[model samples]
Target: MNIEKLDLKSPDLVNENFEKLATLFPNCVTEGAEGKAIDFDLLKQELSHAVVEGNKERYRLEWPGKREAIVTANLPTTKTLRPVREDSVDFDNTENLYIEGDNLEVLKLLQESYLGKIKIIYIDPPYNTGKDFVYKDNFSKDAQEELIDSGQKDEYNQRLIANPETAGRYHSDWLSMMYPRLKLARNLLTDDGVIFISIDDNEVHHLRKVCDEILGEYNFVAQFIHKNNSNKNQANLVSVSCEYFLCYSRDLEVLNKEIWRIEKKGAKDIVKAFNQLKKQGLELDEVLDEIKDLYKRPKYAHLSRWNKIDEKGVFMDDNLSREGGAKDYTIINPDTGKPCPIPPRGWAKSKVELEKLREDNMIYFGDPSTPPRIKSYLTGEDLSVPDSFWYIDNSIDTRWQKQTFNSLIFENPKPLELIRLIMEMSSAKDSIILDFFSGSATSAHATFQLNTEDLGKRKFIQVQLPEFTNEKSEAYKAGYKNICEIGKERIRRAAKKIKEETKADIDYGFRVYRLDSSNMQDVYYKPQDYDQNNLDLFGDNVKSDRTADDLLAQVMLDWGLPLSLKIEQIDVSGKKVFKVAENSLYACFDSGIDEDFAKAIAQDEPLRIVFKDNGFKNDTAKTNVKQLLKQLSPETEMKVI
Candidate 1:
């Protein structure tokens, strides 16, 4: 048996596209110099009834470097995310992740593991207001070289090129930068997943067009108007006090079928008060009176209709009549044993359904002569659909951040209430939330806060570029050299504050990872360029600076495994082994591997196992280990890196 070598690179999207086309039209799949290529003319003929021609006018959002952007999205990256144990909160057990890297490369690295898994993506990217910097994806130079060529090292880096409005490619540069990232982000969304992009007037129109092209125009859900600022005296023409959140789904039909509702504002506090009043063991009449008095307050005025209480809790009487004519039926009052008065239209439910409701004591009949009403319990009907307009004050968030850090570290962070509200509306209890453009880690902070409130197991993945802070800025003076530092620190402080307030049992920890070059040396990727005479010069294919943990991380990415899975270190025949997800995968980079160690591990019958190329004592030992595994555990597949 030939042992497989793990391909330590991100997925090749161009080949995947070719395979998809081949499956749809086999006749159009022709062999080319490199590999299977598409016969575009034949494919077009199959798709259309008329003869298809090239260079024909069609509707598309075109811009300078658009083709290059498309190429960049398709290209595979050799970058890897190495775990930072010291910076992490709970490196082994926590499911939450905070990654520092250029989001473009990070998204590509996550394509295999997180594909179609993210339920909600909320990003607060740069508004491109002429002063902000746009990410420039240049594959030609190394990261350090690019940073140096852009400006001084302490200033903005090349990845963040200043796109002033005076430049000729102002709109084009922003579009090119956003196109590839959006394309990659769409791949990570679940079928029913949704994305919320926060933007201002500067590029909302262009961004919407780009999203329509990539995420599909039919998937557009809503363009929410968030009135965040009450004071906008800097405006030239009008008081531009609101920003927008453009929401789109991967598949709108699927999302529409799912219920997207949030608890009514002030509803939870009313429930808590009702529960407290019940705990006091007051009389039912007294309890009702107290609830009514509570609802009279201005804070609970919206919930005044639900002041009535019974053994089943607070509720409001709702109309039981249906509009536009239905089958009229009499609902008997069980208390009076008489036919209750019916509305002019009809009862909303059928006879059988009405009997079910009557048996369940859901109908409220005040008098025998009056029409019966449905008792809509507050606990059962407390949810309401979110609206398109939201008015949240921006100063509230600024104040909270200042209090959390004891210093003003970030400017204009998103409101925690807004993020929590969005998550509650669109996400499930255990859904994965991603924010690739996470600035001060407000999304993660909001996730922790919401989880504490609802006891949810939702996990968050925050990715941010470690953009350098200005030398004279408060963030730098406070010992934060980069944006990622501020983001991570905010999460820590927010988690601490939330834990102290709620004392809730939840996963308040996160694992930190930093993007870096692959752990493998150049020879591992390109062995064809070397000859046997000089092969001994580079004895180990792995990098000298890389450790076992780094290799494990890269292997996980290469094998399409999530970085958040539980990882445990075990001992097998006095050799160190890394077990992930309890035998889902096992890796051991130690040397002196022989038949005894192979037999020891194969007995556990792990689903997959990996070893370093030079870990075996010799070629004979490596060949024998494969044979040993085949005989001992036929189900276990082995690989080498």
Candidate 2:
């Protein structure tokens, strides 16, 4: 539950025990194959297939030259121990998370435990400008192959080739990097989920297309163009002064119908206008005005009708929605008129339903001598419909970005104020948020801040690549080490601010997970050439970098796995190995599956097997795994975890 108890200390972790751990993977000893047997044709096809455009709720994934499935299948659904107050990586009450690694892998890692639970996701991914900002990643590359696969020498570990502007395939490269990431991000959202993506002209058009392809364009909510530049140079043919924020709903209409809260001002304006009309000497022994102008709100307009009030501040009252909410008269039911024809707009409550209102003496008939109204305490106020545009001066980014970019002192930032509105509109106070690019963790910041402000407990899951943060910048000059540094710092600052302002109403902390090698140990291969030092280093109990799947697998292990299980292996990312424990146990060792023969013999279940990305080979045949398991005859339970 705590760090000492569960082992999450800090960033020092990567440097401390990691290198020593990489030597333990089952395939590590294979000496790192570098052939690039990846089915380039298939990879291309998948990229072109547009999962978003295709609106794939779920799909069968299969990729070659990599074992993405293996890694994903085994990813953790729950941490072995929660990052409790003692184990907490950031704030004590925080439910936000920061993860470092390829977002695709990170998403796979999160699939099981967090599926369909996240409420919002906001990201600013690399546009894949020809200069590559993203590293081409692969899990199948063994140690030896990793060097070549990365196109680098041992001199630089974190450095990756930036997409140069000259590449003819700039768009392709960026899309390739984003394709899987966006696909995975979509899965993390709850049914009423929503995602906000920030992009520039570089890929805004493409991003929109992709959203249409994946989430269904109908789910597209709005594209807000925010001024991102003031033309420092101002010498170009056209100064592209603004960037775009693309939004999509998991199910837009439904989310919108149930989600967006009304803005306070709008609510008050409505009431104020009604009161004004009453004061204007309109003939009225009536209650609940059937004003037509009330419903005529303009799209994209920030204005609202002013409602009326006398002393206790501005107020507006509209029927909670129904038939006949309009026509009315009298507060005491006018000669026992018994609630004035049930309110034209239809009461939010039914007559029988509102019987309690009568008992509570809360319902008022009306005041011709006064303006009819409903009373709502500001403290108990749910937000009104939030404006779609998220205004920011870049003094900050959302909480996620705040932490992510804090070191850079990048002047402007989008406050969680914006994200909070979106989330509130989605009606998920404690929902999860996902940010693949996770710039400075602004989204994360917003989630935490909103939680504290509203006494809501929204959660967030942010995925950021260990993209290099230039050490020469203002942030680095301030002693910031990397982009993640900026990210973590933002959270710390945001937490402090929230506590200062809101009196610490909710958790403002976060759990941090980084993508790395798998935790599973592969039995040692042939001993190296006889050398005393080599032998000492090669001592048996080796540890590997924890993979996305490894994290997931560990989470399941921590949750307790039943021994009896059935195993099903899907070849989605790699060998999306599913371990089923009757109708219960399900594990996916999809991110690192290759030695399929041994694992097939090792288990049983009430089992289901699943993998990450795409696991199996094209027509590779699963009967082999099924028949092999039965023939081995060793049984308890089997399934995908």
Candidate 3:
């Protein structure tokens, strides 16, 4: 009989790293004082040319708890994600996910399944201001128990204020809280994926250095300045209306060094005008006059500068010469019949490119003394590249967020337009976007909103720690006990509003999973500690309090199948059976399972099958079942717990 390892937890990363290194350089891998340790002296010799040794002043970011934080990241947790079906929206059919838990442990739990799979991760972590809060890192303590004792087991108050400026381990504590989470988050990113972290002045500098070390300094994308607030409060020495988003790519080279941009809202009217004129069967000149009338509107004043119109639509003239790296080129103006005067920095386009543009009628030569310029069309993929600095006016700031909730449920909630812009630039249709620090679920709302606009099927995973709301706060009075409540309700309200307003067929649903202790019982583990006589007293190995659905969820977690997949229950001759993701896995948790049931299930040619150890009436029945499965479905992997 095979006794499967019953403990479900994150893998031991240190040994995994050693094994990977051993695979790469087997000669350098030798048995040491400790079992299966890397021979560093030999490894350094093998990589002699590239190794950097000693305390020889190399650039690095360090904090007191850095090593401990790394250990915490590498340390495995036996926690599992427990599905809360009652809290979910369209539980079985949705691709969206809402995980309520400590993000550190949650990140570890997701590492194996989601490794190198996510397309975008946008997190708005605590800025580490004295007023802000960070999770109290206590890996040894039972997090669930602590939450229960603190009256937060339902979804509240696991966060503690890490008020810096007075505490000895002020910065170190905050760094410790963020370091491991960031490391595990990087593991979840695809090769070309990108991460955006929001921070304020308090921790932006420190956060940058930490991200540089973890994500690599070369992968650094940009530190985008967001004008988050519209009203200027003369509260401090300098008006602090801006926040920053530090972006980094998993692999810049693989991204093709190219990123998409969001279409400017100011250009929507121009597109509408073009469509209207086209419907009227107007010629290019006739359309120009109508479009010119549109440009006269005060709201469309920005389009006034883009006056030139042709079959290519509205365009603005751009100087041939670039700012710094301009090339010299000669362009004979057709009107003057002579080479146009070159600008101070020479031409922006090369000779061949200039000739091509000229032939394509993209250049204008209206005057003799004036330098010729390229006509940049204002239609088609005329998306605006996000500037290093940007402003989101109050009008676009959480209109739906507040209108749906009918109250201000979250303080300083990120504007939906802001995250919509981020997702548009970084994600493709069907991309998975993860936001670990999903305060008020703005990212989730934005993902839904954008999908409706473009008809793209982008999914999202939102993780929040259930930080409690203040007793006197508006959110608390409005019936939101914690941040998770606010977050989930926001998505529900936002989805309803979007559906009612746009009539778009969008998947604005999500499955809810909460972090909890593993479903396996104490007897399953420490079997060696207990005698067979005493072990029998516990009866079944699985926890008595756990239901069949709980066991199935644990199995899904172990198999790395997404929790959002459809599940169906069927009966096989008085035994209950569960099928996950159609053919991906089949499981039976009912007792009295027999060879007949196994043979019946094997007929479907399932990829994997699992059973409870005591589910069979006898050992002979279990043995016969295995043989039957092997004969019928030789490729099926059978496991018992």
Q: What lDDT tens digits, residue by residue, belong to model 2 across residues 1-641?
A: 55456566556864344334434332221111331123333334444655323233353322232244334434443223212223235432235667766566556666656777777777776655454376565544565677766776433244255666555345544555555666677776777788888777778876777678768878888897665324423555876566677888888766766646645434455445556667776644221233334434432123323233333333345444456543333233443544444444545655554555545544444553432234443322435555545434444343344354444353344544555555556646656667777767777777776676568766667666555556666766777656766777777777777788778767666766555544434444465656665555443222444443343445453344311112233433343434333335445544334336435434444333333322323224344454555555445233332
Q: Give the TM-score of candidate 3.
A: 0.78
TM-score of each: 0.77, 0.54, 0.78
Which residue pairs show collisions in model 3? Answer: 157-468
| CA lDDT of each prediction against the hidden true structure | 0.87, 0.53, 0.81
Off by over 4 Å in 3: 1-56, 140-159, 231-233, 257-259, 269-314, 319-339, 342-367, 523-537
Model 1 TM-score is 0.77
Sort all candidates by TM-score, best to worst: 3, 1, 2
Span of 10 residues, lowest total lDDT, candidate 2: 28-37
RMSD to truth, every model: 13.5, 18.0, 13.4
The worst-scoring run of ten residues by lDDT in candidate 1 lies at 149-158
- lDDT accuracy of residue 92 in candidate 3: 68
**Cα lDDT tens digits for candidate 3, 1-641:** 99888678888998789879989999875443233457677687688787656445557766566788889899998888888888889876888999998898888888877889899999999887776677666555576766654344343335455455555556777888899999999999999899999988889998999999999999999999887555434675777788899999999888766667877655867877887887789988888888788766544555577877777678888777876635455878888778878777777888889889989999977577978888977764577776666566545555654666666668787777789989988899888999999988989999998999899999999999887789999899999888889888888878888899899997978999888777877544574678766756567777667788778877887887766667888877778888878878899988887877887898788898999988897999999999999999999999987
Error of 1 at 280 (Å): 21
Instruction: State the lDDT of candidate 1 residue by residue for 287-372, as single tens digits.
Output: 88887887675445657788667888888889988886455567678999888887778878788887899999888887677788
**Candidate 2 off by > 4 Å:** 1-94, 128-132, 138-159, 227-237, 252-257, 262-301, 304-390, 395-408, 411-415, 524-553, 557-641
